[model samples]
Target: MNKILIVSQQGLARSTLKTALYGEHIVIEAGSAAEAMARAQEYRPHLIVLDMDMGGENSAEICMTFKEHDATSYIPLILLSEQGQKDDIINGLHAGADDYITKPIDPIELLARIDTHLRTKEYFADLEKSDLLMLFELIDIISVTRNPKKILDIIVEKVSCYTEVSRCSIINIDIDGNLAVVASNDLKKNQKITLDLKNYPEIENALITKRPVVLEDLGSNPLMAAVKDKIKHIVNESIVVVPIIKKQNVIGTFFLRTVSTLKGDRAERMNKLCQIVANISGNALENAVLFETLQSNKNMLENLAIRDSLTGLYNHQYFYARFEEEFSRAERYASPLSCMFIDIDDFKKVNDTYGHIAGDLAIRKISLMLNQLLRKSDIAARYGGDEFVLILPSVDQAQARSLAERVMTMVREVSVPQLYGQRITVSIGLATYVNKNYTSYEELLHYADAAMYRAKSAGKDSIFVTG
Candidate 1:
């Protein structure tokens, strides 16, 4: 409720104005200007209905004093005067009185003026609250430490709390115009693949034009083609697609969907809110995309520094690093860790028979086959061309031998598409490091390398264990 201060000396006049305002506002009455000043500081009224003629001295002087004081300077002052003289009205306006009415005042006019000013203040307050909440929610989502997809999920959930946009989804468009849903508050379990826009060109055109597509009938609409099969009965409802733009180019779109069509004032109101959501979300999405892009690039570069580019497997240097890490972990936890050094059988002969390109392809295919067989915890690195190494943490001797056999089987079974050969095989040497058995990880690898030579001499495609 708006606080209103009434400065009038007569008890009768105060009671009359009290009845005029009634229950619509809280009225604070003061008999003298000094009392009014005190109440002005305390009440901080939205509008002050001041009687200039109440004090014995010139009323204009009191209005001028109210204007000079910072506490009452910006408060909307409605001057109440005994006479509406041109000179007195001019003086009142200069003294910061927004409007003046001659006393005895008309009740209807006073109520109308008070209602207008109070409504204006309320409008500003609502806008301020909306802005604060949006900033708070956006900051909360950005500060989260989970996966990138989780951030998109939080954004979708918070949009409903913001305004009347009941639901929102965040989608990302790849270079080929495939629409992949990054996050959605609704449909959390749905994992349908990319939406082909070629089948639904109207939605694409609407988004690119930067105009919202207000669909009254979805069954016949062009955009419905993209969403119809996925959501049953959704094509029969209304949809509003607001395109999210970044740097003048459209990145993705937000769906403001409803079960029924809105017309007249409601449609216009929703349209305005949609524009506001677009402006704010567009800027936010751009920043998120830029941050995510930089992060992805950093990860790509870090992996490249430690990975073999040709085979997309870890390099020999990474194997050394992992060996040290696993050795330290095994010693600390008192768990068993093992390694296997593998050498492809007759790789040189296979390369000479075909070409270096076929050799490269063979190595790549073998690497992939081994990867498909290994668990995610296992690390496979290309120790050198035609040779690889595997590190298994928390694995005993028996489990390591079993894992090595599975990898050999996978290598032998895989069919290389380009350079076909069924004679490809591998020789693997296994070594295990129990508690305190090896002082350094280098010695562990040395034992495994020795066993690898034993396997080569004994027979190809056979695993040999360290003594």
Candidate 2:
């Protein structure tokens, strides 16, 4: 059962409605808008029917006043009049009438309109509840995924469709007062209104303040007026900008607007849905920040694990693992390949005179020199203190020796800035497997190691190879 106030001055219209709605509802009759307003405040009716032709002088003005009134604003209003033109109906609708019922109103049609509007109001209420539930689910999803951009994408996609909005954009402000266009939906991307936040100071202020900024019309809002004028072709009608807030700090902004004025429950839903997106987006941003911090630490640890601390080349373990891969590849393809072992000659004498710091610098210098001289196919690794190794594929012993000699000469010529006058010599051992001659990659490395020691034993600053 519902409470309804009917404002029909015509005796005929009043009698018919009262009898029709007698059993189902508490029906109150008011002869004019003044009486209707009085009765509405006193009774708090859920519905009001206002006659356009005889609604206390100016029916349109009365309708507006009724809507503006705090007591009757929430109650749905029905406008009845003889003027049933499309413009008249539109004006009535625009004047805060929930529905427009013309003169000589059909009892069945009139009742149906009432039923329909009431049913719609109930549906909107249900939609609100469902939206709240969906919003909670959205928050959970955002919290778990920890991806702000992805969450924004979902927000624009799901929420805009639910609310049937034209487009959506989320603008994030950085510390320097500049803003970045962080995320937008598919519909938003093609939108001509490119909200390049960099140019808008008002949006920045709104974002910084963590407030909801709604521009019912760009032409009216002073802040948007100037920017709107510049890009008037793109920005027209209503625009809603909700600040993304978290922990009492303004992180960013979520923008929702349309080329046309968004009206009724959809308008309320749009504004609220934008706020909801802002709330969850803020959380997602926090998680994303924390996630990036953790990933940075993890990446640092991974780099340390695989890289030599001194020379920053691949460590011995990493080298061996990659060597097995490259060797297997070469063996399968029967491609020519080469491996070279290098040891700094009289490294102790240099370390003793120049100190450990200088020894570290020397290792780094040699590593850089070798890296610069080697081909992209070659992999260089620090085997141990003052020792390095290289795995080169598709090369014969002749080519390997030539590359080794070139590297050795380059190392000798490079001026170690700190050890200006001191000469740093190096001994090298080179081996190659042009065909699948070796049993495995390990045998090739073993042969290279023996050759390196031979070079060291024969004489310092010399090259050795196993036939």
Candidate 3:
């Protein structure tokens, strides 16, 4: 039940108000300003009715006191004055009276005014509840995704939907004062655009103050004077920028623009919501940045473990591991698998004539050529210095020989500019597993290596195949 406090020195006036409000509300009466303040603080009434006649107790000052006190500030205050006391009525309202009733008070008008203020209070209460619920929902939704881009996108999308703004965006400002629109309601996810900080004076002010900046009228706001001409064509009439702060520093802002002019209670509510969201965004962005950094470090460590630092190909240990698995699969399924061993001819001569650096360059060039010629399923790795190995799945002897010929032709065509335009060649040996009774994949690799030595014996830059 709502509590109403009626302050009047006259017994007749207090009785009249109580009689009218008795059944609908619980009425508390105070005969003086001091007693009225005591009752107001004790009961914490939903509304206050103060008679301006106060027996010369400065009724307007009493009203101002109630409006200023934290406990009674939000309680609705109505002033009762004589019918023609225009100055008293004006003074009461100016002193923060929410409403007023005349000395010859009409019971119906009194009831109606009281009900209006009570309904407005209920509405503001509901709005506060709804805002809190929306904030919780937003936090829940953004917390489930680990992608930094998606998290920012969700924030702007939710804010835009709730605020119904012309534009809602999360902009990140770096230490260099560069602004980047990390996410926007109108843009695709992961799409970012750079913006000049000077163009957005409201955002710049918010960042400087580390507080929310609101401009209800862009045309009239002094902060927007510099950009007034540039934004003259824009239909938006209001803008709000709430800084997202982290560790006492302003990292970014929740930028919003709307066509409607937000003022009074509506503007205050919007500012409160955006400030709460900015606090939440700061924590969310921090977690996302940390997650991305950890994920990047993890991937870097994994790559270093399995990748050749020089050629960027799979290292020898990783190649052997994969070879074991592929050979087992091929044997189990009775599928054809080919292996090739390539040895660069006179690789030591290049190292001796030029340097080991040129030798490394030549090896890198051949590695690149192999990578370009091979299919996705083919695996190539540097088995050792100047010696490379390949494993081709689902390839027969004819296919393996064809691939070896191509590798020789490409390698012959490659000239090392560091070797003073000298061309180099490779001896390649191809071995295919069809019906061969190879005990293990190692046996197949041995056959290919033996054939490569035979190619070196016969002539350089030749391919030899072992049955």
TM-score of each: 0.38, 0.37, 0.38
The superposed Cα distance between candidate 2 and the true structure at residue 177, in angstroms, equals 40
What is the Å distance of residue 424 in model 1 from its true position?
A: 1.0
| Predicted structure with the largest lDDT when compared to the true one | 3
What lDDT does the true structure give each of the candidates?
A: 0.69, 0.70, 0.78
**Cα lDDT tens digits for candidate 3, 1-467:** 78999999999999889887978899999999889989998999999999887887998899999989998999999998885576888988999998887655556457756865776533445256667777888899877666767777777777777774667778876433467888888888778899987788877666544456777767777888898898786524666677665532212334433333566677667766776687687777767765775687877657656866557677778888888888898898999899999999998788767654356668877888889999999999888768999999999999999899989999998765557778899999888887756767898899999999999998878989988
Please list all clashing residue pairs in model 2, or write none if there are none.
336-394, 336-395
> Per-residue CA lDDT of candidate 2, range 1-467, in tens?
88878987888888877876777678999997778888988999978888776733777778888899998888889887773254666777888987776555455445545654564443445346657766777777777775556776666666655555565666654322234555556445433334455356457545433355565555556777557656575355555677664532222334433223575555665665665566567667766755755676777657657877656688888899989999888888988778899999988777656544355567877888877877887899999778999999888889889888897888787565446478888889987886676878889999998899999999878899888
Model 3 per-residue lDDT at 64: 93
- Consecutive 10-residue window with the lowest summed lDDT within model 2: 248-257
Show model 1 residue runs off by greater than 4 Å. Answer: 1-297
The C-alpha stretches of model 3 lying farther than 4 A from their native spots are: 1-298
Worst 10 residues of 1 by lDDT: 249-258
lDDT of 1: 0.69
lDDT of 2: 0.70
Per candidate, the number of residue pairs that clash is 0, 2, 0
